[model samples]
Target: MRYMSHLLPLSRVARLVGQPRSTIQRMIHDGELDTFDGMVDMNELLRVFPDVRWEDDGEFRRVEEIKEKAFARRVYERALPGKEVLAERLHELGREFAAAKSLLLHYDRVHRFLDDKLDDLAERAGVDAVATLRHWLRTELEAAPDEAARAEALLAQESVMRIMSATVTVRPSGHEFFVEGNDTILEAALRAGIPLNYGCSNGNCGECRARLLSGQVSKSHPHDYVLKESEKADGVILMCSYTAVSDVVVEAGVAGAEDIPVQRVQTRVKAVERLNEHMVALRLTTPRSRRLRFLAGQHVTASIGGDAGEYHVASCPCDDRQLTLHVRRDNRPFARRVFEDLRKEDTVDIEGPGGRFVFSLESRRSPVFIAWEDGFAPIKSLIEHAMSLEISEAMHLYWIAAAVDAGGADHYRDNLCRSWADAYDNFFYTPLSADDGLATLVERVLAAHANLSRVDLYVAAPRPLLDAIREAALARGLALRGWHGEVIEPFPGAPATG
Candidate 1:
């Protein structure tokens, strides 16, 4: 017997099955699962994940526990949708349930009418064939279909998901993310590592405006900027002020490195964490009204107490309001200031998030990162961004630093790297000593991969080593465009070596 088809977006399907989006995509790629117009049929989802217990609350609880532990108290609270948005979402879901119930009631009435007609015909015709047909219809109607229980459970779980989050799809870029808790479209996009253009996240600037293509959204926050009447009639909305009530398609521009204008933000020092004797992690928190926007692997000029220096951001852009930079003990005035006297709550002026050494958003190839000495700063940012993006390709990291006792650039965040490797099945970490001559280190790294053509390699090192690795990698079949290198000077006055 044929059943009604319920189509779900891939993101929702992944959540329902308790799997990563990449896993679902892989299933589709391998022909293990089927999709129509990028959506999975409910029956197809049931067929592929037969063992899933949609009625079980185990998965839901597990996820909640992880979030509770992973995020700070304030952050966890912020992740929840505002009461206004939550109420609207619930109201929308109720309307859907009401409509479905009405349709079911109509179908029941039709079934009864057909049954009465069958009886009338049987009584009038007085034929054995008519009686048999009537009996068959009654049996089929009275008995439950084999998939009834599973289908009901699926619907129940989906209702909960709808109440908790909504999916959003950006046109042109085709990036998808869940609007969970109380996030506006812009907030969710940034958290998902999709760098959509925006300025003054509180809605003073009209930079985050986009045209809504489908689905419903409620204004979760008020904005001072007014939309033109024509623009409003054309379905234009400011992403920062609107919360999606259902799966939505929007026409918004995804900003590239060049597309992101330089932003000057006044930030306050949150903390100064000494990673090791040689390096300190400067944590700065931006004002609630304005956050600095920059891509992974980008460097920003930060000035504190009249001393300014350029440093690669060590934190992910997904880290809202907070920015972290790694500074080494050197003669640079800014570096010295951070080590000598920078304290909590001190004001820092940040400007010009310059440099093009950023993640290649378009590529799905496995990323191989090589960091020399203190060059791990940018590499760390890129890895975190990759994790946030949830890329399916395997990631390999190589940190070449001196031994802790040797006093060279030690792996200050070694434990953090180890935790990532332990947590993710697709992430791999390898730490090598700089003592292993640059040539030998290159050979060792190259030997790990038999084929380099399919991988995107990012290297951060002094110019000489960077050029050497690039030449060797290209000769070994690495795509020329896939090579990204950033020069790391040993000290402030050192001449850049090519």
Candidate 2:
């Protein structure tokens, strides 16, 4: 392999070093592995694989580097006679003292070595070769101290060090700045004097979401809450999970992390059959290790091939390990590729394991209020999660939906409805088209359940209903906070406004 010097694929090198393939590719783009073009194979990668692992993908190396640089900056600050400069920091941070460093030897082993040589050659040797210049220098003068110093200074001055850098765009808040760059977007933002909004810098908190109007960014952490492919093309990104891959522009308003939950890839579409003219009951499957972790009634954004706005996850956050999503297709909204044409084995991109609608038996209230409409997707998850925790207290549920068709493979609803009817306080059903049945969403739940905010009130339905029920509960002076509702499209931006 060493003798061949070429032909090694990057995936193989990634395996040898125990890293993700994406990491290896990022390092190459960051100029860390600038030795090759795009692909790194047997001979080419083997050359640099020994000393460095995955440069972009390395968690430990990045942190340590940040620490070392911080130390260097501190030393630079103390050593400065007056104003601090980056050069002063570099000089103070030298690990070894004055060891006659050779410029040729220093640049030879780096990925940028060849590129530097070519660029410098273009400027100095476009018409004359270095050999001819050296011959002239030897004949013209002997080794002069001033000339040698001048030559070394020029060479040193022309060297490029920083590889992945970021810029910033200040948001309307004026206090917070949106970060964009190729490698470390947030890091670069901090360097540029921007107060980047962050809570739990890890990808778990969906606080760092921002729109990238231009340029590219890479994830600083591995993430399951990936934006839809269409959203990516449209420039929406999760700042926490992304490291700018190139120069980028964005809206930098940090959505409060506590308000959002990170979506994890837990299951696949196991069963899909129609429940009504506009609804489909989807049973999703998942492995034990990748089980979902979320509260009941919380929902997720589900998309195929990254087209966001496909649909929302109707699953219990508590039972997320092996999750479920009951999709009531607005035939109009998901009429295209993601929902209608999506099939088994197709990858689904999800975001938001969100919504505050949860029923905790621990509360003084025994019965949790559940308003189910259109379908069983969202409501079933909440009920199941509540029962899993043995909240034996009655679940006073008002199942509100239109069963427009009985022949459209609506068999799944029978088992789901029967399973919970015997287990809780009361199961109320209402038909959408019927005059007496569908009109009283908030009114019905209020009639049967207590009005105190202490009672967990859950509403999962169309956006119109969600807003109506939410407003009614709050207007009654019953602190209807901790309200959890499931909507179809992701509420754009990190702001709590939407």
Candidate 3:
């Protein structure tokens, strides 16, 4: 589905709402908002966030000013026939501008040189005017090489001739950006001043993944991230890693208002309670006016004493001012400080709402959440958000983790899972230990489910485990469309693989 669009980038829209650019990007990807040439429509923005005060509020006054300027520019541009027509007109105008300037400069230089020669010849030659004229013409001819060099240099300095080897048209937005012969799609979009949703600027994160609706593209770099076979068949390409070999049509989505903008907030440690020997619950409170607004399953980076690390938010979005995270004790600097030195009322820097592991609020499919150890943090948030929506579809959670201690058979927060399952008619929970082979467990669980393809599966685990389960599920005829997962960073003390 497509929505009406304006020419304002997502950043401007995010700035108006005091949110992160990623929030708006997520909305577009989730089909909540529409964009044209990387911009959102004003009417659509007002419709999406009707609560925003445009008439009386000081912030919105600035937004209105921006809107007026943008609309005026759009009106002037729309007077032209079309983008291609405008592009051709601009190319012609540019050539004319360059040619005119070059002509003036060339004439001025030649005239000065000839004028000096004529003055010199007039003074030197008394009677032979034709001879003097001949001498001057010879001098001008001799300087031709120098004139040619100057003209070449001037033309080189002008970027009026852009040889676009390929053009990328993103649809159904009707936005077009050009690609240089040697540049990747992401680089070309950025160079052409086109806004695209991306992260890391490398292929490892898969944040810039998009579908190639037509044309050819080739890999330009090696990416550590793996793409599923189904995704390949659907023409998915990592924008950061692929260069267009021909005029390509790609489909990339934009985000919406429900995605809370990410920001750096000053938070005070409200409490830190040890959940177990290896895990702790960290609660934080942000300033009243600067509270965070994030979707469930998003992450935040906590920084203190020159240390920072990303952790998933374990709390629900309903509790905006207050934050919660489940931290696993590790040798990493951030975790070490949180475990040994962190205290209540201590100030900390929290930057967040990162990651796209968010729950799709619009999806009606039954959700199956899978988590490994403390990776359950985001899953907890997702479950709470799903409950808040009062969704009618059944939701199930399968938590797999190492036993807390030797000879201990219980999983992390087993009692809570059992309580939730008992309390809610639509919710179910299963706890599994890592000792149970991942493949075996996945097979058993998937077999228990009736429609594997119709379920929305969200997983949070180490990359290897997530990959294993994904392959196993696919083998069981699970659809790849609704799969989502967060790759947990390895612990500091874990064995390093070369």
Which number leads on lDDT? 1
Model 3 bad stretches (over 4 Å): 1-260, 406-410, 490-498
- Output the better candidate (2/3) by TM-score: 3
Candidate 1 similarity to native, TM-score: 0.91
**What stretches of model 1 exceed 4 Å from their correct place?**
57-79, 117-140, 144-146, 491-498
Per-residue lDDT over 1-498 for candidate 3, one digit per residue giving the tens place of the 0 to 100 score:
222232344544554555545456667868888876566776566557656433343334434554567547654332222334335435655775698789879978987787677777776775478566767666765565533443343232222212124557776654455555455787666544344556555678787889999877777666888999999999999998887655578997533323345788889999998887778889999886466656678898998868888889998765646789888887678888889999999988999778888876556578999887777889998888776544557889998776656322135577888898997777999887666676676776687787777788899877877887788777776777778878976433332111
Q: What lDDT would candidate 3 get against the real structure?
A: 0.68
In terms of TM-score, which candidate is strongest?
A: 1
RMSD of 3: 22.0
Clashes of 3: 12
My TM-score estimates for the predictions, one after another, are 0.91, 0.39, 0.48
Question: Which runs of model 2 end up more than 4 angstroms from their true locations?
Answer: 1-267, 287-289, 310-312, 317-320, 331-341, 360-362, 368-372, 403-415, 424-434, 437-442, 450-454, 467-477, 481-498
Model 3 TM-score, all chains together? 0.48
List the pairs of residues colliding in candidate 1.
80-181, 80-182, 81-181, 81-182
> Taking the tens digit of each residue's C-alpha lDDT, what string does model 2 give over 1-498?
122223323433444455644456557756776445334544344445544433333433444565567547655333222212233324432421233345434644552554456557757767556556645544544445543443333223211121212233334432222232222454444333233564444566555667776554555557566567787777776665666433346777633324444745635666665655545656666654344334455556666554544333455443324455556444344334434776665555556666655544235453444444433455666565554433423455555533345212132365566666754333433322212333454676665655555566666555666677677767765554445565533112211112
